[model samples]
Target: MMKYEEEYWIDYIKNNELNKKEASELLNLDIYSLMKIGDSLRSFDTGDTVSYAVSYNINYTNYCTASCPICAFYTPYKIKKYEINKPNKKGYELSLDDIKKDIEKAKALNVTEIHIVGGFNPDLSIEYYESLFKEVKKYLPDVTLKAFTIPEIDFISRTHGVSIKDLIQRLKEAGMDAHTGGGAEIFNENVRKLITTPEKISGEKWLEDAKLIHSLGIYGNSTMTYGHLENFDDIIDHMIRLRDNQIDTPGFLSFIPLKFSIENTPLYKMGKVRYPSSGDKDIKVYALARAILGKSIRNISVYWVALGKEMAQIALLSGGSDLVGTAFSEKVFGATNRKTSTSIEELNHLINEIGRIPALRDTFYNLKEYY
Candidate 1:
């Protein structure tokens, strides 16, 4: 067992790389001490610049085959096929016109990124995504298309009988600039089984796909969903795995510690999980992320939609260097019964209120404008 001393941990964070045992010890530190260490680390790694994106989230469909217990956005493709029910309750697939209208709104907002992710709808083929990506590019050629998650890509590959390399190349040809970091709930096998369904890709598969994505010259953010059915050890292990993977592949631009929203989801209704994470726990995850992956993954993103506005600000002060984005049409969090709307003005206000320099960033974390 490692000794727990604030002084020792502080010095370790500053001078040495963290092992899993050391990371677990750091997670037990008091919130204030953790925040202090995390803040210092953040300042050293990224300086005082806090970045955000003028981005729009487009959930192309909610008819999902992977009925993950952690998700409320999906309506179970089986149910959708049998009943053909309404959206937000049963299932919904947005038409090309629907996506076009959403793109129009994003254009009006001058969004730099069009973030798209959705379920593994069996009906949708590679051609569907190809056309969708092409249309999005045609309408807004300047905006970066950061689309698809590891599980989504894996499922599409298996369902459509396409190789991962071929699928990615096709998407790139159709204007997929990057990938999103969803579907990485927890890397631990037992905990993941509790939170998500078997239909979802395994943690190892997720990592493999990420490596392939990076090898293909595409970069994107990575995430770990916490606050449900996981211990400090699990969190530490997750970050370490990500750290090692970043060392190996070097494509992940940011690490996002997503606070699991339990309301309106199966995880809550099944009585397997009890409540959302407390404010302190949320902040600790941010701090721990910095301590563990601060050197490897420089950008720690504070996803405000999962953590509320105030917690988001606190996270920025602690370890987070980015405020995710202004998720214009975010529906997954909305399905969890949380308000999921924000604007560039609101994001800037939130960052300014926290006294960090707010900068508008593109999908690649390149600072486009500073305010």
Candidate 2:
């Protein structure tokens, strides 16, 4: 294995050339040293200001076809289809009127972005999304609509017998601002197969679609769902893949290291995974992402909805430069029995408490205001 001194890695970060091997070595460093390197890199890239977005999350439906082992938010439609014959026990597919009302609520709060994601319902056609986006634009033409993950997009494309490029074009024409980076659990083929369902697309396809999205002039964020059955090597591989893709396309807005919430997940029930990521591992992942990705992907976001306020604060000092968003109705983490909502006021206070400047940003990381 390649060994390097602390100064060697530090210089590599300064030069914006930290390799995958050097990034992997950072995990072995003492926490303080690792954090110092990460903090320095973050400060150099983004300065002392920590950014966030005033956004709302709308999971249009919870009934899904791919009931991946890692997810607790999805209610399998096959199992619950019969329940629809009963009363209120079945899964939901939000109506267009319901979505319009949600958009109106977001507008009332002066939200800048509307984050839309949901389960891959085989029943919903591509026209459903097109109409949804079109109506959102009609209600709030200015609000940024950051919606759908690569997996959801892939599923929709295959279901409609259309190409991903074609699907994205139609959505963009309707009103999709950018794609979310969920569903990328771990890029390693073997590790991903073990964690997710077989129906889900591979990491290779995810990158290809992301590149295609970037080529079309729509930028988006990237994410990794860690703290599951993945090792240090798996983590490094995931970051490396994201970094390489950013180098090629350069449209990734940020990198979010989502700590796996295992409370209500299948892995937890099956006795395969027990706990959420410890605070130590959480900080290391965020910090290492800064060191590894370097200049390739600048923004490292700490998701407050998943990590809670305190750990999210700690992440700011470590390497995180953004607090993701003020998710008004975040359900994914809530389904896992974790806190899933934060306000603009609370986010500002958290960033200030950490002695960093707090700012509001648009979905594209454009600074709206600095507080």
Best-fitting candidate, scored by lDDT: 1
Query: Residues 238-336, candidate 2, lDDT per residue (tens digit)?
Result: 999999999888889999998899988999999899877888898889888888875888899999878888988888888899999888888888898
Error of 2 at 196 (Å): 0.5
Q: Candidate 2: where are CA atoms >4 Å away?
A: 1-8
The per-prediction CA RMSD against the true structure, in angstroms, equals 2.2, 2.2
Candidate 1 Cα outliers beyond 4 Å, as residue runs: 1-8, 85-89
Instruction: Evaluate model 1: give its TM-score.
Output: 0.96
Which residue pairs show collisions in model 2?
Answer: none
Q: How well is each residue in 177-279 modelled by candidate 1, as lDDT tens digits?
A: 9999778899999999988888998899999999999999878899999999998889988999999999999999999998999998898999877889999
Question: Which run of 10 residues does model 1 get worst, by summed lDDT?
Answer: 1-10
